[model samples]
Target: MIPTSKPHNPNFSSGPCSKRPGYELTQLDISTLGRSHRSDIGKSALQQAIEQTKSLLKIPADYKVGIVPASDTGAMEMMLWSLLGKKPVDVCYWESFGKGWFSDIKNQLQLSDVNPLTADYGQLPDLTLTNPDHDIVFTWNGTTSGVKVANADWISEQRSGLTICDATSAVFAMPMDWEKLDVTTFSWQKVLGGEGAHGMIILSPAAVERLESYTPPWPLPKIFRLTQNSKLIEGIFTGATINTPSMLCVADYLDALNWITEIGGVDAAIARSENNLAILTNFVNQHEWINFLAERVEQRSNTSVCLRLSLTDKQLKEFGQLLADQQVAYDINSYKDAPSGLRIWCGATVEAANVELLLPWLSWAYESVKNSD
Candidate 1:
């Protein structure tokens, strides 16, 4: 039987996710559209975005939050280029994005002292093996694999090295241990459901000190340079970006930020995402054919929830298409580098009711694909 109901918004893509419910382009303030980003109006809007982000996430008073270029990928690259060679590094990876970072450290940067710690798609590397004295690079959430670090308990509080995190999928929807993180990067397009091409980097005081004291042996691109003559560039954090940004995107982000605030800030947003996952959790628990990709319960991500269905690879593809054909779900297929499965965006912007509606359709799609074969 076909599911009579469907998700109100079938935009389950892991990136550039669904916008907040009741989101209207007309509601966004377009006052800064024609203004130059260098203008006082433009800079003020950018700076407000930074300040609101810091406040919502409860980032430290001493930490610096800046808007950067090229979304999360670019921010991660910039941090890697500017910081890695100064110290012996430990790069831990579980999925594609993490693997990309590890490759950058060992292959691209060609850093000789790199220590690579890895795990298959559904598992996490042994974070306990990380040396406190060596710089650490890893993702807080494995978006492709549906796994996430349970907590910052594995990180050493007394460590001499920096903890650089790619927290793109976990920031607003998850409770973060900011003190344990030295450098963190995310984008506007994740849990916030804003437009893309912009990234945010949050730097702890220790990270700033490192920037001021050390320089990478390699040449730094103008976009990646965080300091000049061993002095940290203060303007970037205060809204003077390294490159031009889309004002329309900025307005959209501001609208989303305001939505988060109105709905009880980050706590409420986290609860919404958790509830969305809970809806899927109940369905998975009752059905023997579907299971979460994450092996550990605690390590499962509430944002990018990946699942394995009892279907062949071809069947999996057909199952996803079936859902899309009925407008039940969209972009729910697993990442290309990940196993054959479904990856649902259970982020803050996604509604629990929509998730509930999506569950019955999953069973219907599975059976439809199964019977055809």
Candidate 2:
């Protein structure tokens, strides 16, 4: 039997995740709607977002945080196209997003000294293989397979290379060491559950130096240009967007940021996500057929909580659909490249109590499917 009460919020998609609890469209008005983003009102809102991100993430004092175009992908690619090839690169991967980067470095940039460090899904590559002299690119969390880099201890503080991280899904939901990372990027669509199409890029002093001193061989599009005539663009860091932005989306993000402050800040957000993961962990511990996609407990993502099931691909798809059919869950299907099973977003916005309620529904769907088969 399906549970009588549903999750207070049923949005579990990994991207553009459920907005903060009590979110309403009315809460997002900032009096800048339909105004040019270059205007004072629009620029003030944009700069507020940059400052808000810095306040919540506690970025390094010397780092420059800028709002960029095309979500996380755009911010990352801009850095890649603008900064790579100055040194050898050590690209690491454990899942689909990592593979995409690998392709870009190999096929797109075609760097001569690129070294591929890889591992199967649900596992991690050897961190020690990254050469200090080589620029490194990696995703801090694998959204598809639900595995994340445990920490940044493997990185050397004295390394010459810039450690660029695509931390879209992990930020605000996990602990990050600013001292260890040189460049990091994330979109508003993930942990904060804000609108998409805009990305935030944080650059340490070393990263800013690279942009000012060295330029890649490739031609940078207008959207990807970060430096001009040997100087970093100061205006972009202060909320001068490269293109027109959705004022409504910007307002929504501001609302989410304010909610983050109300809910005890970043540490509180991490604890909430961890608590949600704990609730799901306890349920998974009792289920024999369902297991974590990430083999190592330490590597498991508390946000994008992926699971591997004993059922076949078709069975898993049907199960995912059944849960959605009953309005018990939504968008719980495995990622396209991952083994078929379930992927649940247990990010900060997800209440632990809602996770607890969803457990019995899992049992209901599983049993009903098994009996039907």
Candidate 3:
């Protein structure tokens, strides 16, 4: 029988994910909204975001975290413009976002001695291909394909080059090996379920050293510049942003962080997502028509859960629309670039009960679409 109970919250978008459980707009204190970001009132809000982020992630004591303009893309570009081209480079990519970094080095920077290590959408590349002495770039999680690197064991103990990672989708849900990563960038929208348009750039001591010691040949834009006269800008990591920021978004992020505390901390947050994925796992296993995109258990993501349904291209499109119209799920369609199927956000903010409610609806939608066709 079709399930009668429905998920109270149907927001499953990967980027701007669902907010914390029982989230309300009234919880945000927008006292700094109308004030300038550089003013003391605004800096206090910005400072809270930076410090709280460090605490929740358990980032290294020595690392520096800075707020940058745009979202994750802007923070990643800032690292490439400021720190790349100092040495030979190796880029590893399994999905679209990782491929974007490869293009940046090849087409945009036109850097010499660049090597690309790639694999199909569902699998990871050869981590051994990177040279320890050469700068390496990769994404910790393949968001579009719902695959993520299991761990950071491949990195050497004392590598000369930086290990830059686009970890927008992996930060809170996955346990990060902070020592293995030299430069990591993530957006506020992912696991935290906050507003976008602001990005956080995390720098290890090595990344900071690269910024201070080596200067790239390309002229750095004002927005991308992290150093002044060979010294790292200490102010950016300490509440002094390069440009104006929306304090409303900042306040909302603060509220989200506070909710993380109330929800039994980050471990509980990860557990919520794990439980959601587990529910989906059982559902997919029982149904012969649907299977996980990531073949290996280790590579499967707990955040963006991608599935391959047994259906034609035309049928899958109609099926997704049917699910949406039924008010059971929204944006369960796969990414545009990937194979046709379904992708669900199981981030920390998503309620496991909601994900449980979603699976039976999937079965209902599949049958309805097939019979109608």
Q: lDDT values of the candidates?
A: 0.94, 0.91, 0.89
Instruction: Evaluate model 3: give its TM-score.
Output: 0.98
Query: Can you give the lDDT of residue 5 in candidate 2?
Result: 89
In the order shown, what is each candidate's alpha-carbon RMSD? 0.7, 0.9, 1.1
- lDDT for model 2, please: 0.91
Best by lDDT: 1
Residues forming the 10-long window of minimal summed lDDT in candidate 2: 364-373
- Per-residue lDDT tens digits of candidate 1, residues 178-227? 99999999999999999999999999999999999987888888999889
In candidate 2, list every pair of residues with a backbone clash. Answer: none
User: Which of the two candidates, 1 or 2, achieves a greater TM-score against the reference?
Assistant: 1
**lDDT of candidate 1?**
0.94
Better of 2 and 3 by lDDT: 2
Number of backbone collisions per candidate, in order?
A: 0, 0, 0
What TM-score would each prediction reach against the true structure?
0.99, 0.98, 0.98
